[model samples]
Target: MPNITFHTKHIFSALLLFLVFGIQAFSKDIKQCDLLIQNGIDAMWEKDHVKSLELLTEARTLAEKNHWYKQLFLATNNIGANYYNLLDYGEALNYYLESYTIAVKHLEPKYEMIVLNNIAILYSKKKDFEKANEYFKKAYDIAVENKDEVKIGLYAMNLGNVANETNNLKKARDYFNESLPLLKSNPQFEILAKMAIAENDLLQKNYNQAQVTAETLLKTTKDLNYHDIGISLLMILSKSNFEQNNLDLASDYAQKIFARKPNLETKVAVFKLLSDINQKKMHFDLALQFKDSIIKAERELNEINNGRAFENNRVKFEIENYKKEIALNEAQLSNERKIFYSVLAIIIIVVFFVILTLRNLSVKHKQKKLIAERNEQIISLELEKKKSDNLLLEKMISEKETASLLEHEKLKNEIEQKNRKLSAKALYLSGRNELIEETLQSLSKLPEISNNNLLTNHIQTLKSHLKTDAEWDSFITHFEEVNQTFLNNLKTKHPKLNANDIRFITYIYMNLSTKEISSMLNITAEACRKRKERIANRMELSSEIPLYDYLSTL
Candidate 1:
């Protein structure tokens, strides 16, 4: 009886060992499957779709074998994303539907919402707005229910983009506005939202507001080096300036967009803008040149699209084959599972002690390895944090310098504008003095006034007033205030120049015409020209250097 009890105890221990090892192996496979799926997601973020597909496919195999519903859903969804990026829309839709089915079967609302949103994006790309909007609304409702602010903003922006594409400007603007607050954390998305708003403003013929919005966004994009969004903002600015008849400014923005090496669609739009601007400016030759460029760009774009279509077809065929292979593997795994279990049960009875010893050692080894890796990661993070802090400091310094330079430029422009106004006032005063002098001369020559002593005396007093230096001195002082250091600099450069010569240079520096200068000096225009020639000679300037240009250097 004691011998019988010992044999029964041994049999019970064998069964328990088999159960424990089987469950451990299954758990290990599930963990590996999850790790692969995470790696696949990282690959997707890096835009390596081919590698991502491979990783996700391996993960899917493991998930299907172990019947891990959550991992299966993720692996399947990522597979769809790979095909979607590859432009195999048909295959992409098939996998997406499979993922959706899994999500529904498992009652996973989060996965369902994400899959729906992706489907909406795919439809929007295909220009099926009706279906896109339907899916977007469904996804948006789910996001709202889950209180996912990020997804909410993303859907709103997508809807806005679709509305803008359809030329529903009002609806697009409203949607973009709704997205702004939600997407503020993501600057790129915020920029895109504002760009949509600016585009709407342009479509509605609100050129000024559109220009302001586009320009503000443009500065932000340039600072961030966001070339893609910069292209869109530049296009909006070009259109806004074009509609407002600012042809030169429009051409400048369009040319900047071209210089950034835009893609086919943006290039076509830029070429069209250039053509229209040139045509408006009566530059028929340039217009024709841009029109030819447009044709070339459009032809290239068509060829590119065709190539993509062919590639998509090939990818779709490959995906179909891959699906068949996965199905076959599933069938084979199902057939092999019972046989494997029977074998595993017998092996466990023989190897239970050995397996337990190895597993314990392995667990300890893994713990030490994990501790080492954690230490390395901590050090790496510290170094990275220091580098980030350094980069942030450099960026702050650069921004501050840029702000300082801009402030200096603003002050310089304000001074120049004030000088221009002062010069205009001085010119008006000179013209008035000239007119009074001419009136006095004409009155003195009139026959009716020749014999009147009182009139003659009044004319004489006026002549004395014109001869006084007070008014001239006052004008010179005001001119000096506007053009600070100008007269002094000129005198320092040419000490031989007299006060009259200095005054002539000041008038030339103000960019006054020869006739205006002659009137100011109460001399003939020919005399003023001769005076300029004399000053140029005195300064020993070559004929290539005009007197006005030389005076400007002062």
Candidate 2:
């Protein structure tokens, strides 16, 4: 094994990270669990799975007690995340679902979005792009609602990756660009920056720029130890060198990939590249041997390994799920036991209270009997003995209090009326928003969004809300109409396209640029561009018109 030494300056940086997390932890209790979860996230970003579990376990333990749904959600998220790093997708997905279930229970939109984003990421990895896109878009909506720039940025990055995988470089660049501005000083963010820049430069065929950015990533990822991305960067760098005919540099990079991964697939590619280099150097024997080795390795790597790991994980997951069910049952039994004990204690307390009350009632009954006996004497002396005048005073006080309460009731009714007015306004706006969505659907059924007078009144009503200065709630109904009418019309025209596909095309033909399309649709620009290109290809456009220009013609 090669002792790959990276730069040693990361110790101080690691300490600084710890200190930052520690300070956040010290500032408050329970409320700062999000900060703890953030630390766990940083650990995951650094590829320190062991540390990730430690922080996340501590964070998850307090989730029920703390209001930090994010912390609890992230604890489950990190567990799956670590499994993902290990390439154990099944376990990762299981944990991801556990987190998602908690988010649903809490009705927390933000963490629910994270679960959705991660699910999309996993599906994409599994080559289920359709499902991946669905999940990613759902997550993007919640992220937008929460104004979480970080999550939006990550969605862009992942969408770019999906674009890159699908051979849509133009779209990939757009998505990467959207993410670049939002990532701050995290190690993972730095790698993503390099990756996005790499995608952009590579798409433009700016080999030098790509090489420089990739090399910078190589330098920074020492303590980060993200070997998978590092190796991919190396592969691209090698490809760039090979394209530029720098065979010596290309050979060095190929060697790095082989050394880092050493898997059969990588070895075959590396061996082929080495063979080419050696043949160029007139080392015929070495080249021929590499070629032979590549053939044998190909057979072993492709046949013996395919689906083997996945099947193993499926079995493991099933077993673990069964165990979890048993544990849950045990927990329920324990809870039942606790409830039984509690009920018993309550019954004992009730019995004690009842005994005391019965004794008091008996004494009261005796006192009442005495009062009954004295009633006749009191009646005889009633005129002379105005000694119980205190009782009359109590009656007068009660009457005065009732009158005061009646006076206050009038003010309460006025406040209730004001609240009712506000609530009515809210319900009106909600109903209008729904109506606009229906209108948008109708508009989309036609070739163009209808500016016809039928909707003129509805749009006017919505605009009136803005005059009342309900900024956030205003314009929502109008946009809903725009979205629905325009989209539904397009779907009617093109029934072959799915809901997502129709939305993708509607935005394009509406003169929305690729970046705007991605942002509005909560997709990566690369995805938007690719989807557009795909639609254009399906329609069989010619080179005489650009894809977007042709889409406008539609």
Candidate 3:
């Protein structure tokens, strides 16, 4: 070889510098895109749809140029959200589908789930509940596949909301029930699920129950500083009370919403509710005041709606042209590929025929030898087939045994999982009851509550409703149902165990730590351990064997 002395260090330094600079530039671009997206979202919230679209479009362009699928997805999806809020379903659906395409092609499945939800929401706004349910179920399935509890709860809540809209109250309740426990740690979604359940109750004409649920949720949302959720709860309460002919309570809720200075739609609804309430009371003058307010609010709402439609059309045209450009590029690329593949196929065909022709020329001379070899091969194949059949039968028998074992294990795991869920629910309820009790105690000492008989009575009623044992009874009922066989086996083996002992044993069998069991049982950790030891002593088990381990054998 020729003598070649390369400046390897210099080349390496140059490459390293290029890499570092490339990363910096890429990071800078993404930051800029993020800033644009945030500003676009802010603008959308401000109802400046035109400005929002301008910012989002710029971000989308940068994201697309750099192949940043996440940013591109956010920008596109937000634009769709803007259109959605403007009541432009057609434009919204187009942008949503475009984002869905990006998510499906370039991103992880979780991104696709996000787009699926958006598409479902758009269909929901269009009152296409069937299509909406289809997409919502797909998103929920993806959440299940990913083992994402938060999203599972969220999508389940969405599904339930849609079911409520479609008048399928039973199905709605089922979804909500499945969602609530999974969402217990997620206050935002848990509130939404509760709201949906209350809405379902309202739709089913269970007005008193709906009011109670909404009233409880209002307090929860208020404590969490969830202003919008509180407003929604207020609306539910207002509607439920109104349906029950509790005009005074309904008017009070409507006034609360009005005092919050909610959106024009809410304002219109409140104004109408107040007007009806006053009219029902024969206060014509007060009714006329609200009636006039409604007219003014409706006019403003109408003007805004008309303006949004015009602004949306202008933006829609621009977006449509941009899509057409992308489509044209894709069409050109596809056609080029088709031509390349066509030529390659033709070349392959020509080569194949040449090979076939040569093979035919040698066929006669080798035919007799080939036939003699084939006879020997046929005898070998028959022997192999007999061996294969025997092996196949053995494999089938083995697979059947394996399948039965697997099914038994699956059922056991399912019961264990159900018990775990029940345990979680118990813990949640325990914590919630403690918090409620503390709140009542604090309120009882407050001067305002003590001085006011009505407030004190309300507090007393709330205290009466706080039946800690009732919740535990419900939990035990469910736990017993899920772990029926396990419980029966344990009882049969330990007939001397009492109900409380069995409860303790049940907690131990769930593999809960000492602290968790203590909290659930309202006892200290030391006491919980003593109780465990006592139970073991009663069961006549050795000290070396742990309670959980002993229970597991059962």
Kindly list the per-residue Cα lDDT of model 3 for residues 1-554, writing each as its tens digit: 01112434665888999999999998898999999999999999999887788789878977987899999999999999998987877768988999999998999999999989989988997889999999999999999999999999999999999999989999999999999999999777788888889999999999989988988877657453363676778888888888888889888888888666688988877877887777667565587577668667766766676566556666655644554454455446655755565565556456444545555545434444544555565566566556655755665576566557545644654564566566656544444344445556667677777579998787777566454667667777998799787889988988999989987887777777787677666667799889988999988999998778878887
Worst 10 residues of 2 by lDDT: 1-10
Clashing pairs in 3: none
For candidate 1, the 10 contiguous residues with the lowest summed lDDT are: 348-357
Better of 1 and 3 by lDDT: 3
- The CA lDDT of each predicted structure is 0.76, 0.64, 0.78
Error of 3 at 519 (Å): 65
> 22-64, model 2: which lDDT tens digit per residue?
8787557665677778888898799776666666666676674
Candidate 2 accuracy as lDDT: 0.64
TM-score of each: 0.57, 0.45, 0.50
Candidate 1 structure, TM-score to reference: 0.57
TM-score of the candidate numbered 2? 0.45
RMSD of each: 24.6, 27.4, 22.7
